[model samples]
Target: MTQGAATPLPTPKERRRLRESRSLTQAQVATKVGVTRETVRSWESGRTTPRGRKAEAYARLLSQLAEPAESAEPAEPAELAESTAPVEPSGPAGTTGPTEPAEPELVGAGAPARTPARKNRRAPSPARPARRRTPRREPAPSERPGTPPEAFDALYAHCAPYLVRQTYLLTGRRALARESVERAFQLAWERWPEVAVDPDPAGWVRAAAYEYAMSPWHRLRRAHRVPEAPPADPEDRKLLDALLSLPPAYRRTLLLYDGVGLNLPETAAETEASTPAAANRVLHAREAVAEQLPGLAVPEQLHQRLTELAGSEKLDAPRSTTVRSGGEKRTRFWTRAAIAVTVLIVGATALTVRVAPTKYEPVPAPGAPISGVPPLTGPQHMTEHDRKLRQRLRAELSGGPQRLAPVAE
Candidate 1:
């Protein structure tokens, strides 16, 4: 049958019998119908009833099949009267039943009421008392002032092994374990203001570490690096090695859920995966770890190792190469000064050449007037001999004797 298809409605007698057969009090039916117990009682006694939508909803609930009643006999008149009477009203308005008299059973006492049992099965179960639990006390404000340094320290002290395990799982390199943790802590320090306020600092660190381990920079750094030997403890080392060998996705989810003790939903949230996806990741990671380390115990030795590793070491502060040593600044200052002086000297030499004035000397072609000198007033058409003698006379006047060329052939 298709889901949500409307089913057949129940008769008033069927509804009342269903509720009673299911061991439901009148109030239960009243609550489902949004009426008082008096109303439910009225419906059962055939005096008053729900109609339209309310009636349909009542019928739907009563249509549910329930377990067969223990006794086959019809209820005694007194019991029937008591069952149909209005009980104390509970829940909201429109849920109370109307006052009414009881009706005779539709079937004889010996026949089992299959219809009632079917309807009663659908009746809602009785309300249960809500459990009360003591809330966990939060750490004092003084004890947990949110700061990058505080968070980094806490993660290093309390959550290092899990991180190491995660790093190992991702890269399968023992040496990267410490570096990954350090890098994750460094990033946390850089963004401490935001990270410290997070509800789960360790989770934040783990996620950051996972991201860092997957980054190109981390990959390049680890490529040439050799794996460090596992620790002396066989169990501890074995778990670490196994974790390191897991794929990144599986390793991250597993560490978050198993190593870090987060619930499935919490792990999903931390890992940015759906709950089902996170569950799958965890399942695969567990299987992988189990397969790799058959003799390895995940619960006992791994937890102990993680705890011990967390306490034994501290995260070192990130190093800075930005600080200048003595004489370095002085050397740079002198270099700049020398370049400035050289530029100025070269500029002055170029300017001197560019601005200096050039002296001019005049040259005249044969039979042409000397430029910038006084014009000659001799005849325009003169014999070649006269021209030569005049040129010689002019040359003599200018303090240089001129030689006349012989006539050309």
Candidate 2:
């Protein structure tokens, strides 16, 4: 049959008769047909007609209903299934049904044909009263001020997987998800009094997780990223691929709304955006998501599928193995490293401060030169010109004629 071809649905009376013949309730039949009980009622009352795949599903269920009543065995009732009482075993003993062909009766035999003897059966044990379990006592409020340990545990159980999955989708890295969730939870723990009292504690943690997931700190560890596909079912793999194609901010807005189950205002507050902006982001993201769907799906169909997909896949649990949060550890390591470097610099500078010979030479005494005039530094201490000048100056001072003397000297 063609995929789009609508299967013929049995008429109202026929459908009701088939349902009764099989001893099934409307709810049971609706579950089999993948519709609500009201839908089943509407179908039986000729109020509406099933269409497309839904019609096909109804047709398939009708075929099952056509089978003999003995062919179907509904599961045992909850009480019977969980019953621990010893069975009150009583049935026709030593009496066989005609499951096996009976041997030909002896001609004109007075005694009735004897059936095969039944197997030996054991007797039931006596019933005993169920032991009552003692109720555990709650710890005093003095031990835990506002929110108790149990409350935090309950919070963690609810939000941890949700935050992790959100981070994982955002970063496309499992380790980052764990790290983000861990950091978010740590912050929550530190401010439990406030967070516990807040209207949306999960919102607070989710915002923190989003921040951690998008942190630039992750860039330093990019080299350590091992290229691998996310753990997903086939359909989810396609969805993830589509999601990765979207811009980071848009992708985040989408997940926060659909994946994280936040409203426009909550998502906006977390994203530090206006409500309109968040809505716009969601719309854009849906458009982007729609592109990832196959050719068979129209925009409306794609949207419906996406909504269903989002609902179905909370990804509340991760893979068996995980790379837990190392952000805190890394922070501590970097802090120590910076401190060590600072210490080394300070020590080296201190050791270098000690005086060097050339740097701290003692000042020489400032006094008159040994000679009245500086001694000549050349090979001939005095030049021939100096000799003449000296002779002229002595002649003049001794009252001799100054003519033809070296007056310049």
Candidate 3:
């Protein structure tokens, strides 16, 4: 038997728009489609496409959704047809106009229909060349609508507690986990200019916390050298041990991918690794964990377990105000220290200049001995005069007046 041609799906963006327009949640869609929400998310993200029977079902659902719009307005069918028509090149010979916007997955039975872009545009004249448009620059963090401080506080309040729990899983030490998350936020606050503008601010903080939690330097600390008390439950203890047993990279990759529910590309990006490497790490970590606890062989089970393990512990994050204040204090201390060092260097330089020799000096020539002077000698080398004196002294011992008269003579 011959199979029918496959349905042409809408762009990823259109797929998402259709669902949102219908006021449907990903979970509701997942339940209807007999797939997980993550699968639906991946489909909408354009990371993966639906295949075979699911594709047909999805296409039919989207057709039904578009059908209402078509039935509601007599004039919409033409626009819908134009939306589906293959985009024609309207620019120079080598270039083409922009393609359809990214869309979400389809949900119904018939072939998927193309959805129009957010704004309607007339076909460009074939004679007119398409000009290159410079991309619009995003506003700086400070330039954003609300107060930056408030934005930062909001971000901290939302992410800190979750990060602490995640860090605990990464390090298997509750105190260190809390410390890692707090330190991460402090660093984030310090670099708020950069962190505030990031597409994934929470991820920026998470990466920092993960890096700090897994740092080799932590191993040198006396407290970190000793393991923390295991979870009270044997299952949790076993799972935690298994996670700790994996290499730091693998453990982090697994957590980001499975536990945190990030897609493969997002996980890889956060881990600073290539997608393939992240995949390998996740696979290896999963195998290792499953070997230890056979019941957690599935990714879903592992995710649930990680959540339970992290939630069971009392890993509380410091207040946003505390983190902000601490960061400010650290910044001030470093600034002061830098200034003091600069002053000290200048003082030392001034002192060196004050004591340094101003001009070159030459050594004096040694004195020459007098040509006619007799050579100096010890008592053993005395001349005839010295011997005669010694004899006169010996004879003078007879009388003091005689010796004095003789000496005068």
Candidate 4:
């Protein structure tokens, strides 16, 4: 097929369909195409387009795989095909190598095509299209203009139960998990305008729930202070313990990638981390879990174990109506608190103005001693000169008076 000009590559959806129709896994395709499974995933997701020599090689490989898939009768559902397909051997972490630009993949290059088994199943005809699964329900009506409170309840009811279980894995405390899921829904309700228009509303709520559940502050809460009881089964207990033992980031990455079955890029996007960092976290988390439960060394087993543990717990979400009411109550409480604070500030200012002095009053000056004045003393201590002057005055008066008296006689 590579000898002639390569057939034009199919659309992303077609590429994925062609691969699945051949019962070929992404890892198998990646192995055959000399690229990482993530690169193949990106190609199918239409995030990036392959180019250069790799593109031609990928095209030829897909064309080869397509020949068999196109001619073969529809044997089984895609899920069943995947289930029956042989598992690829796990490789070392470095097997994927450094991340490459996203590219397409070739499926079933060396693998045998699956043959149809059921006699009752009808072969798809050219006139009639093959049966397809029903598309998932959308939240289109939930975001209509002036949507009712029930719209939020619908969104909550759809996401809350599963999210609670997911958060429980993040934080081992059941109470904290329930609270986290409820709080996340409340936030979503508060930000409905934005969340309603979001591409992935469920993801928005999930991220919020994960953040709140993994918060360090939850440790301070009395209810979350003591650890929750471990799962009854030894295997479930070990798995939960292993999950809780991982760093929050690692655990979240592992759950998103393995448990939730999100691709690496999607997991990275949800976790708000780089792809390589997210991959690293998954590796470390898997290693940690494997240490405790060697049976779960394979990712598929880990995913199954996670599902079982979550299902085993009775971590039911609160009613959506109750959550909406709680959110509304919280909003009202804060609003009233803010208004009261503003009124208090304004009233205090007005009272201060009314009681304040109308004019400035100067303070009185302090008294000080007067200088340059004689000191008061007693007259008993007269000077000798003062006595002499008084005696002379008396002598002169006595002599003059005696002469005048004789002349008159």
Q: Tell me, what's the RMSD of every candidate?
A: 26.2, 27.4, 19.8, 15.8
Stretches of candidate 4 above 4 Å error? Answer: 1-146, 358-409
Residue 208 CA displacement from its true place in model 4, Å: 1.1
Query: lDDT rank, highest first?
Result: 3, 4, 2, 1
Give the Cα-based TM-score of candidate 3 against the true structure.
0.57
Model 4 per-residue lDDT tens digits across residues 32-81: 88889999888877798877776877787788876765444444343322
By lDDT, the best candidate is: 3
Of candidate 4, the 10-residue stretch with the lowest lDDT total is: 103-112
Residue 347 lDDT in candidate 4: 100
lDDT of the candidates, in the order given:
0.53, 0.57, 0.69, 0.68
Q: TM-score: which is higher, 1 or 2?
A: 2
Clashes of 2: 0
lDDT computed for candidate 3: 0.69
Worst 10 residues of 3 by lDDT: 104-113
**How do the predictions measure up, each by TM-score?**
0.39, 0.42, 0.57, 0.57
